[model samples]
Target: MLPSTYRDLLRTPGAAAFFLTAAVGRVGIAMTSLGIVWLVHGRTGSYALAGLVAGGFAVAEAVAGPQLGRLIDRYGQGRVLPPVLAAHAASVLALLVLVAEGRPGWLMAAAGAAAGASIPQLGALSAARWSALLRDGRAAELPSGFALESLANGLAYLAGPVLVSAVGAGGRPEVGSVLAAGLVVGGGLALAAQRRTAPPPAVTGPRTARSKASAAVGPRAGRSLVRPGFVVLAGLNLAIGVFFGAMQVSVAAFAVEHGVPGAAAPLYAASSCGGLLTGWLYGLRRWRAAPRVQLVVGTAALALGCVPLLVAGSLPGMGVSVALTGMAVPPILVVATVLTEATVHRHVLTQAFTWLNSASAAGSAVAAAASGQAVDAFGAHGGIAIAAAATTAMAALAAAGSRTFGPPAAKRGGGFGSSAPKRGGNFGRSGGV
Candidate 1:
């Protein structure tokens, strides 16, 4: 079933109204945080620099993400959010001030880093709350919510970069900063409006072995935050990250290197949004087949699709190559999403999501910077090759981990879901049976 009904997402629970309120805030925060890319690029006149700044933001968020999720799990959102929001506001304001003050590139990078680090827990925290509000069995709601969030992500990809480029071209990076600041402010206000609506947080003190094992979960899954199925999922994600990061940098860098730098934004936006349009349905597939099968095949298909890029000769070819590449992304992301939601405990679900998301960020930060520099030295195809190598390495890891990664152990307090490689929609395990 679809996660929350369309009406349900709009409705507020008696005590969890805050979740709905926070959703709006999340949208604003995402929209505006991204707006800074155009702003910063307009100021610096370097796409690589813009990417670095954005990568810094993503890196800080990725590094701190698991820790932040832990914080939310350890403390109530009420206790955690306000101060972080305040600090976030201050940091962004500092960034704005520097922009206005005409700060040097290094100074801008430093300010962006601080702001990115302090950007509060808007998206991550909001997701946690959404799951919580669905506690009274709106389970379908959560997945749909996620799908909608995914769709929203697509919208942001389309709008944020385009909007920033438009405004930046008007000769004002400050405009982008101002737009980011305004969204932050509005998001804060929206979240404040949600104070009374959110569900109580589900964090309990860390579950010790016996106590946790006593629950309905398998013994292994009951203990570590990691689970067997989740390992497979995360493992696949690790490779997927290399693919995603490499693609991002490759597109941007290739566009510039190929003399169609202006084509970069639209090409990526089309690729992502177009793929996402398909992802929603992919998520809705009601796949009774094992996710392991889907995962391996998905990864291979994605990888194969990427191989076409070696021959991309024009702006149009670039777009086609990217769009085909996009086809691989959603299946992996959605399958991972399903596997994780199915296998993970509810209390730590947000943290699980956060951790998985962190993997991609970690990969992107490391790969984007490395690949960007690689292109400068090795040229576009060489960068592409390196990226392809990185991604293949990831796929190989998932394949190796497949032995241990299987269906959740059946016995009580057993282990993770079973992970036997199957046929058809296989993920990273190649086409093997």
Candidate 2:
């Protein structure tokens, strides 16, 4: 049975509709990311091109994220999300047409660039929306919501590819393309339903106001997203990213080298399973404990979890290491997320989220190449050890810099509820960055 908080919150205003809409839409977006690569790769017969295709999405997303987040903060999500998703959907369709029509690789890459740049900021917006909802509602349900959302996000990764693979087994190249489209439309509709539920725009207090102003004119200007606490978290996250990204490439390379490439699946599955369990469990942990406590513990555990990876010389061993390490991820991410919402002034919240997106992408981009090279130079054990060290260091840093993230603004404490925000598109209620 669903809990009282969730059921009650959804029943109010447009919150319920938005929640349903987002979940539905996310499923589609998730599939695009998970399965699109294999589909493109299978057709192109060039891993380099495939990598470029994949990298293009990351680059576009990373480069454009802050602007997208800013737009959401400035204009509201409903105004921006649809068109972006549509453009993305159209690009995927165009790419499929090009492939079917025998277009050159350059053409496909070009098409990919357009699609990638325009991909909706749905992930961040959805997260922010949830944060907004939680800040204004009952605090008890807040943790559970984050936990459920993380699990759902992971499930999207797990299921997107499996579903695509299952559908493709019937020998239809267009199957993946069609599935991607269906998901886009479905997700788009779901997102649309939740439009009314967006919390009132966060109003910037003097601190954020001064920060924003200084960002425009001062020596340290132009980085409105870099709040001190946010900086600490982001810095730590970058290290974490390096660790995870390196592991992602290195793990695959290690398995393939050992002639047991299939073994990677078990480790990956174990990680996801652990993430699923931890996400849900953390919700029951009670939100009253200091956010930093959660942040520190989660990150420390995560770093420690990576320690096992250093000793794993085989598939089963790797799976155990991976699962244990995976346990630390959801909590770290969820804690960071909740903190970002709770602390950063509302006006700049979206920007902070985008900065995070950029961090993840940048980290992945660096890791993809560096990890492979490290493994080549030092062997898998060396590479894994390095990954663990970096991850642990990040956790320690987050612990040291924990003080910057203050308690939530009193007005912003619970998040949005069943009541429609009094000022539609006002973008001034919660507070700005």
Candidate 3:
């Protein structure tokens, strides 16, 4: 009933095309952020300036994310993505040139902002494709589909750094920016070409010209902002991001204090590996718990898992603790995506997703800055304690607003229900247990 491996997902028509396309975009996402930081720091010789440029890039993305998503929702991926990718690539190239030529800081910031504003929302769009393609009667397949996407995202983070290191060898940081731009152009185009998976444009009533244009704009007119459920989801994602950011710095500080700074990457990779394994197994299950309950329980457990990090003095102990904590991360993300899918309207899914992403990004940025200061003042233990506290707060919020996550599909009477009238034709009947 569920895909055992990603290969099973690949066998589904159009799934392979879209997944591979998403992988390309994910790789670009993973490389570009790190690449920009390295390039700016190397050229400017000031960590402050580097941080400022990187912050500008992220801030621009946070500001423009939902607006770009709304455009994609209104115009279709094919029409919207190509121009955006072109602009994004152009902006990156401009940044690359400015850094290479040692241009002033303001110009660099402007270029970084442009790059962020034009960057495509590949993850959100990919998830939306899966939701649209697997809807109607194949609802049971949705979990496996989302799990595969999550796994791909994890793999991207792992592989993207390797690509950046290879390209930026011998301190050639500019090379990574070029490579990242290439990935964006090639991947974005390929993803946009999968028109079969693209969500259909919003339906419009035949009437006044103004009404037609408004309908075309649809979610762009700010419908998603008015929803309380979506706002809560955004806050939840932000908390998760803060937890992740603090944990990351804490782990790095731990490695450095123990005189094996290089071990930090391996320790982080161990956690990602745990997440990847759990995500695969999770997709194969037919769960009894509602998604909202799962979210609350999972977040609480994750918070508790972080407790070990504070006491894990040895490197191996810290690695073990990190891996255990990471096992909870993928499921939380998968559950969040599922809830967003269920709660938001179809027309505004991209916008809703972008809002969640923006919130998370902002939280991570704040945590990274704050945790660094804490680590400097009070050591790695302080950072770990802070991370645990943030996770605890996240758990509390999840517990209080579990209802916003929405009821599970099985319990909602519309999905794989025991008494749902057999509809959706061949796909529906074939998927029936």
Model 2 residue runs over 4 Å out of place are 1-16, 168-170, 201-224, 407-433
Candidate 2: deviation at residue 366, Å? 1.1
> Per-residue alpha-carbon lDDT of model 2 for 1-433, expressed as tens digits?
3345445645656655665665555566565654556556667666677667666766776787777777666556766677777777788888788766767877777777766677655556666676666554344455555565676677777887777776655556467656766776666656754655664443223367754553443222224345687788777667767877888877877788789888777767888898779776765555445666667877888777777688777777887888888887887777776666655555566767777767876876787677778888887766676678778788888889877765334333333422112222211111010
**Root-mean-square deviation of every model:** 6.3, 6.6, 5.0
lDDT of 3 by residue, 1-433 (tens): 4434557757778989987887888788788877888889877787777777878888998889888988777667888899899899889989988987889999998999999898877888888787777776665566667777788788888888888877666688888888887887888899999898777655333586865875865634355445555666777888888888888899999999999999999999899899889887877665556666677888999999988887898999999999999898888887777767666666676777788888888888889888999999999988888888888988988888865544223325553212111233111100000
CA lDDT for candidate 2: 0.65
Model 1: which ten-residue window has the lowest total lDDT? 424-433
Q: Give stretches of model 3 more than 4 Å off.
A: 1-5, 203-221, 407-433
Clashes of each: 30, 26, 0
* Candidate 3 minimal-lDDT segment of 10 residues: 424-433
**Whole-model lDDT, model 1:** 0.58
- Residue-wise lDDT of candidate 1 within 1-433, one digit each (tens)? 4453445565655323444444445444454545567766666567776666665666676676566655555455665666666776777777677656667767667767766666555555555555555544344344444554555455555665566566767887667666755665556556644644443444323575543443433233334466776666665666566666777777787788778898887888778866776666654534545665555666667767767787787778878888887766765675566456545554454566677777766665577667778778877766677657765665665555544444333412422212222344432110000
Instruction: Tell me the lDDT of model 3 at 124.
Output: 81
**Candidate 2 weakest ten by summed lDDT:** 424-433
